[model samples]
Target: MGLTQTQKAMVEKARAAGGSGQAIPLSDDACVCLIGIIARDLGLSDHFPELPSDLPPFFDQREPGSLNISGVEFLPLMERLVKLNPDSDTFFSCLANLHKRRLKYERILQTQPIPTIEQVGPRGLLQFGTISATTLTGLLFWRKWFFDIDNRAGQETGYLFEPIIAHAIGGVPFSAKASPVRRAGDSRKGRQVDCIRQQKAYEFKIRVTIASSGQGRWQEELDFPVDCRQSRYTPVLVVLDATPNPKLDQLEAAFLRQQGEVYKGESAWEHLESVAGPTMGLFLEKYVRDPIQALLNKVSDCLPEFVARMDKDGITLSVAGESMLIRRTLGAADDEVQELPDDASDQIPGP
Candidate 1:
């Protein structure tokens, strides 16, 4: 399949920023870097007899106290190695190891401090100036409470929450309600999943009940699709609330017992408290915060298992100028893009 518009735009931007004619495509640098590291860590040549002698040179290029070879240069070498032993368990293990290393590197980057105005040169300053202007515009736009009244009414009908949650979690909303297949002699009903992130399905529930019977019904709602589609995607239940419901603990436990997952108001509150402060944290946790933190936690927990499974299954590894997008989009629909909330006014303080 061809690259999506967003992917194409990224390539174009990279080229415009002097990334042209680079041996490694700008986008695949991190993956390629991790690939080299993983290969050395796994001792691919030593373990896999089929590995070509030239493969060692790629890893040998690492200089002490200096940058390793660019992913661009490493790409063809990796591709050749994969072709040499396409079905080797040791080869696929390196790919899984690469993913693990990349995840750790990304976590490190997130924790690092942002560059200051002086630290960033002229180009960086220009980028930050645009970012600051956009942020201020967003703040002023959200300052309008009067416009939110109508927007809240629209939200109550449950038309916009899925897109909002999907956007916040960096996931795509599943367009169709139910899978194409139907249970024998049973009428097709709408599936509850609203959004999907990292191969996990998420269903959003607003104002769920605290009673035992109500909780049972909610559990059923969350579990059915997961039971049916567990092989394809893991399931997460996100319960949006106006207040902290103590009974949700029971529901969460029940879902977890069934191999399903749950994230409620309390989880959102805890996340916001860390990032947005106590006051705004309480407000957002009660009102507009999406279950992004919960979804991230789920992804982090699942990734190791996912990598192991991929390695065992021997997923097709391509290092020749392919993007990480190709690795992630293996089973997902490329056309199904995540939709962002149309207006900031859509968010209103809950009672």
Candidate 2:
């Protein structure tokens, strides 16, 4: 939060130039950091959660470049920010400055988190305080859906997690439009590299462990590096989990073979945020990682007292001394049970 190295250098430059009464110059990152500090001091972070966290990197010197935002760019942002305020209570110039500050924020959200969540659909509301029957249902519902939906749909939606971080770090879905370097298996279905940006091909994994997976998938993973190198791209691997595994070691070797880079666990997060720049960096921290961690921490505090069971009958949820059996019908997914009376349960049943 204090002056960053870049800011310090600029300060020294300003001091030297002060005798001539010349205007002090601020680098793009330094200017952004000052704004963030000002917002924090003014306690405006609640209005813009991405404020302080997003601004740190600029000060940290991770993002060093000219921030060329012309009026062409400013107009769209001004229009959007203006729309947010229906009331015109002394906010003409304020909105302009506000949008200038939050330039990358809305775009990052629109391009990243919003789309990822849309696939998951809405999580039903939870009423806090006492453990209500409805609250328990929400917990049981997600856990049940995770397994049941996975088995039925034959999809691992957790794979969606990788793209979230990759895109946050400026990598986009591997497409001819996104990058010129396409890997051997660049088809939409048999996607090889997780994403690509500039001349780097990225492979993102939540974790890599000793546990064995499909040989075909392992082969594809191995092939990714070779394919990327062939396309004149550097294959970079990012794994979020640090759990040590021989398989992970092997995978690292694969990337090393291609003269690529590997980042795991804390380093992976650091690499991602550093590359994400200010706007997308905040998006990763605020909307993505922080929320996920908070969710886990919240759940860990008082774990949900809910259970889900799937049988030939169907899926059933039992929580708060109540049971709801969703019976499955032929050619339709449940589609199963009640364990006890609903005397103390909240009246949240679909019926």
Candidate 3:
């Protein structure tokens, strides 16, 4: 169906009128920041039925805080979007072409140009700069499975050990959507292997942590992937800002070493060759840097120098940013700091 001439004109009119309510025009960076946040808020689902119009008022806040609109309650939501660009990119990148079902509009639109993940899972890999946390959260959210452990029995060290074990046996624990098969028994001990491996499996050597503050005797734990015996499953590692308690990273590392030692003669169970970089910092950096950088480039009137300062640490744009940051970091290791700049202290504030 094609958009009726009347409908097309109406949409154009609405879009044109979209900014008139703006008391002050948003910077290019600000606009993109707004869109990113808006997209995320929409994704959250608690606040439903959002339209383009809901954003201008939020963007209109020109407060002297970390962001262009520090007074706005939605600033944190916006910041999360900025901080999770790679995840956001991966998400938008995965979306297919836009389609409208209206009988009035006949145009079948191709997806907007977004970066593509050439190889993901195992053969395909992608990077998350400052947006590491966001990317991980997004990966979990997108796949319908966040990193959940068995806190009930506390037997699995309060983390999901089954999936970790599966990672050892050429199985990949993807977000649920990426799972090859979904059955009633996925959460079970033995069933996970069959369900995960039945589809294409990619291994993520994630730096995982477990806290004992809330649960049982597992004081703290950190685990890192040290073996890729199951390379047939896509293999990648997710590094975090700090090591978890009980030295899970060391444990996994030792496990790999032990495996190598044990199977040295029998078969190859070698660790992966790391293409090292600033893993944790870059992840957070991408979260804010990419959005601020790109957004500044967009607004004709936006000062790049001004937006650059927004990336500075120890800054909080709005109360919302503060609260949301706290929520996201709730279960994370205490040592991991929110590296993304919340306060644009150097920019002389926004409004």
The lDDT per prediction is: 0.39, 0.48, 0.27
Number of the top-ranking candidate, with TM-score as the measure: 2
Q: Write model 3 residue lDDT over 99-213, tens digit each, in one string.
A: 0111001110011111223322332233445456556444533232111111112321111222322322333344333333233223221111211343232233223455334
Model 2 Cα lDDT, one tens digit per residue, 1-351 = 233344334333322212111112333443334434434433444544433354442222122223322223222222333243321111221211222223322222122211122333253233344467665555545554454444422211222344445545645544333444555665333333566678888887767867667888788778778778878889899887767888899999999999999999889878887887655455556545665566545545555578766677766778766776555443322211111111101000000
Worst 10 residues of 1 by lDDT: 342-351
Question: How does each model score on TM-score?
Answer: 0.31, 0.45, 0.23
Q: Name the lDDT value of residue 163 in candidate 3.
A: 34
Root-mean-square deviation of every model: 19.6, 19.2, 22.2
Q: For every model in order, what is the number of clashing pairs?
A: 2, 8, 44
Clashing residue pairs, candidate 1? 23-72, 24-72
**Which one wins on lDDT?**
2
User: Candidate 3, overall lDDT?
Assistant: 0.27
lDDT tens per residue, model 1, 157-179 = 24335543443344445433333
Candidate no. 1 TM-score? 0.31
Give the TM-score (vs. native) of candidate 2. Answer: 0.45
Off by over 4 Å in 2: 1-148, 151-160, 175-191, 291-306, 309-351
lDDT of 1 at 220: 67
